[model samples]
Every structure is written in structure tokens, then in C-alpha cells.
Target: MLSDVLRSVRLTGSMLFLVDATTPWRSWAPQTEAFRRVVLPGSQHMVSYHVVTRGRCWAGLRDAPPESFETGDVLVIPHGDAYFLANPPDARASYGPEEAVAFFRQMAAGELPSVVPEGGGGAQQTQFICGFLGCDRRPFNPVLASLPRMIHLRGATALDGAMRHLVDFALCELREPAPGGKDVQLRLAELMFIEVVRRCLTTMAATQAGWLAGLGEPMVARALTLLHGAPARHWTLAELATQAGASRSVLAERFVQFVGQPPMQYLIQWRMQLATRMLAEPGAKVSGVAAALGYQSESAFSRAFKKCAGAAPGGWRRQPSE
Candidate 1:
């Protein structure tokens, strides 16, 4: 399920560069609503992350409590809300949110230097690599919807031996640039994010809710696997419960408890997600897509798609990019 969701919302072109700042420095990441189109116009979501390599700093949502991050810590803005990183915790940024938007535009356009020098040029310094990844959030991305606004992960606990070594190697590559470093850095950025999400899944509390949490529960996971694995099947509560080794009522209750929807409703949305993917593919016919998704006819699929996506398949396919 996670793989399918991730496959649907792949990380697109990213702008990654080293941040070198002295003491008394603060940087604000403008909200995605303000700069998502500006920085990466066609992208549906903007994700920003920072890997602390050299020094400690304070980072969190703009209005959230300040969290301390030391060397090797990773601060991630998965939901793309405004955030900040500061050396002295209260250091004033020289630029405001609008100016930050302009900075992102220039940075994303490849006009800025690789090593961005900021702060008051004090003796003490903090260094981290700032990266921006673009992905889609629409047509049903369960993983994206399940995540919190911000994530702060400690390298010590978050990284296994192999991932830690990979991070070290990637950081070393970034610190000392060589030929093909750009490609290496981009892949490293993507892997680091995947690792963080993996850690989050493993450490999730039993009380947590949402798709990821549902994956941790045996009953919920079994039903979800059945639905995601064979989405085209005509599954009813009785059949799903019988196959998952649960009673119909119990299965329905637990499915709603974790997934926030009835099992059949979930399937409808998942089918629409798959339909959108097919509709966007080159040479995809609505009739074939509907047949493949277990719909009785193309009109049925179109009605369902319009209900979920608010546009007919043809209209959506021909719609201009955002």
C-alpha cells in the first residue's frame, strides 16, 4: 500500500544546496501555498528538508514550540507549512516571507550559488543542506494525508547502520563536491526522506490513527492488502471479512476505526486514484480503463471520477497544468 501511494506521488526535480551560516542567523521557509507554484509550478506539493551536518540549531513550525536539533539531525516539512531554523533561537531573519519566496525562486532556477552564506558572520557557525522536493498530493495520496505537518528525526535512532553509512557518504560527497555529485545528492535526498518515513512507521504508537497506523494492525492490514492487491475484484463486506478471517461487523468497525472509512468506500477512492493514473498515461482509453478497473461501463467510471475528482476524464486530461 505504501509502495503504491509512493509510486503515485514521486519526488520530482529538487533544488539542493549547502547552507553555511554564522551565529545569530535565522531562515524562514515560506508556506507552500505562497511559493509552491512559484518554485515548482506544476508540482502539487512542495516538501522541504534540512540535514544537519556540522552544528546544532533550533527548528520547527513557525508558531510551534522550538525544537533543538544537533549534528546529524534531520528536520523535514512534509506538509509544506512555513518553518524556520535559527542558531540563537531568536535570531532575526534579514528577509521576510515574501523575500524568502523570491529567494526560493532564484534558488530553484539555479541562479544562486551552491553554498549560500547567511547570518551575521559571527564566529560560531552552523551548517546544513537545504533541499526541496516536489510531489503530488491529489487524487488520493494516503501516505501524504497521514503525515504530520513537520517531522524532526534524530540520526542516532532513525538511521540503521546501512542508512547511516549512506548518509555519511552522501554528506561527505556534498561537502566535498566532485563530478556527478549533483546526481548523487539528488538520490541521497530522496532516500533520506524515505528512511525518515520508514522510521516513523516503525515507531508509531498503537493509539495512532490513519493509513500508516492501520498498516500496523493485523486485521486492518489484512483487509487493506486484499483491497489494494485486487482492487478490481467485486468485494463485499461478507467476502472481505471471510477472506480476512473476521466477522463482517467487526471488520467494518475496525476498518473505519483505523482507515476512517468503510472498506467499500475506500475501494471506490482507490479505484479513482488508479483511474486518474491511467487517464494521464499516453493513449489511454476511458473505456479500457473503466473495464480494467471493474466498472460496468465507461459512463459509470466517468460519473465516479467526476464525483471524486470534480471533472470528467476527458476534461481532466485536457485541463491545463497548474
Candidate 2:
């Protein structure tokens, strides 16, 4: 199941970057009903997400009021542009910038507040851990393009256990004194974000009733597994259909229905994504990566890669690394 997800994901982009909210740099307590902003000028703009670990908060997006968040929940604010993180819904449109900065400083100094007031309803103090999720915006990032502007993950549900573990692990890594701990935490956060998205995709059919509905199908899941398990293999409709336990015509129809593309179409896109990642890795070579991904020759791989990435493999190799 995981293998398919990985393969399906590669179709959109090659990299996943994570951030640990529990990092000492992120600890904060709301004082004056304001939202905290975490800016990532370097994010790819495909998606920006947050995972909650310690307490509750709200995320404000354009055209939407601030939404509530709780521990173990994940909030995806696509297009990592500036947004608001507030303690109360009413906190929007009235926060003072100076006071917000002062609150950030106070939290940095270990100040704690009790009884955070809620807007339009109740008053309560809320604590929260948040992080950023980064990914490419292209060919296969179906989740991002189809998702709403703001999403709320309900904590205290069956899905909370793994997500909570992810949050805690992220926190620990962020706080670790070990060398490169910060980098490790970020990578883990990216993985957690992908997992959280898949989990949400699983439930979206019931609650969301939108573009993610196809992701829940058994056949679609099978196809994803095959592609992820062997990106280098030469896949044909017949072989894919056989593996998926469906006839070619049926598989084609179903793949289109659920995955939003023909099986072979998805395969080509997925292969290019994998190639892009390999090209980006420090020591990888185009020829070696081409062979690994089942290309007959480097030239063949280069042609396909250029078609998708708008640059030849060698040219991509020469470009600045991400």
C-alpha cells in the first residue's frame, strides 16, 4: 500500500521537506487574540501545511474565517504564502503588530498564559506546535490542486495515533542537540505531511466528496503499488491490468475514473518525477538513473525527461541543485 502511494506521489514531484514545530524557535502562547505568522520565502509554493502537537489554535486564509485546530491535527494552507495563526476566530482583523511581536518575544522568554479567550463563543488558553510542509507544484500533486484553501484535521479520532507520534518525533528531533538534528526534523516533517495527506485522502471520500474520491478505490491503490514498486520496469496496459486483477479495458476505465489518468500516462509522468529526483541527488548520474528506471539507454531517458522537465538530463544536471 505504501509503495503505491510513494510511486503515485513521485508523479507530481521528487522531494518532500519537513519542519518541526516543536523546535524551540516555534514555541509560542497567544496573548492578545492574534495570529502568528511563519514565513517561508523559499518554499516551493505547491503546498504549506502545519501539524499540531501541544494544544489548540486557528489558521486564517483568504475568504475564510480562522478555523480551529487541536493536538494531533494537521492544517494544510496551500501556497505557503503569508497566513495567520490565531487563538480565536474573532482575533482576526484586530491584532496589533507590535503586540504580536511582543507576545512572540514573551513566549520565547518562557512566559505562560492561562485562560485564552475564544472568539464568538468561549474563552480558553491554547497551546500548539506547528510546522511547514514543502513540495513541488506539478504533474502529480493531485492532492494540492484539488484541496480546499483550508483543511482541518480532527484530532482525538482514530487517525490521531500515528499523527501524534509524528508530531512528537518531530518535536524531539527539532529539540535534539545532535548535529544535523534540525535538517533531520525537517525531512521527517515532510514525510509526515505526505502521510497526513494520504490519511486525509482516505477519509475525504466520505467527508469531502470531491476530487480525492478516486484515491479510495482498491484498483487504483493496486496500480499505485505497482508503479512505486518498480518505476524502472517497462509497463504496458495488459501487464498493469493483469497485475491489478482487471481486464485491460476495465483497468483503463477504472484507472481513468480513480486516478484521473490512463495507466500508461501516469507511468510516464511518474518515471520523469523519479528521474528528476535522481538528477537532483548529489552523486547520481543520468545514465545510471536511466538504467535503474528501465530506460533502454540514456538518450531515450533524456528525451522523455526533457519533454516533461523542459530540459535535457545533462542540462538539468548542470543546473543549480535544490
Per residue, candidate 1 scores C-alpha lDDT tens digits across 1-322 of 7777777676664777888999889988878779888777777788888888778899999879889998878888988888999989989989987788888888777577667888998988898888777887766777777777887878686656556776677667756878877677777767767766677677662657788888888998999999999999999999999999999999999999888889999899888888878887999999999999999989999999899888899998887545
RMSD of each: 2.0, 7.5
Against the reference, the lDDT scores of all candidates come to: 0.82, 0.58
User: Model 1, residue 284: what's the lDDT?
Assistant: 96
Best by TM-score: 1
lDDT of 2 by residue, 163-218 (tens): 76776676565444357554565566566766667677766755543336555777
Give, for candidate 2, the lowest lDDT window spanning 10 residues: 20-29
Model 1 spans > 4 angstroms off? 205-207
The residue pairs found clashing in candidate 2 are 4-224, 4-225, 12-140, 18-186, 18-190, 35-85, 116-124, 116-125, 118-123, 232-293
Clashing pairs in 1: none
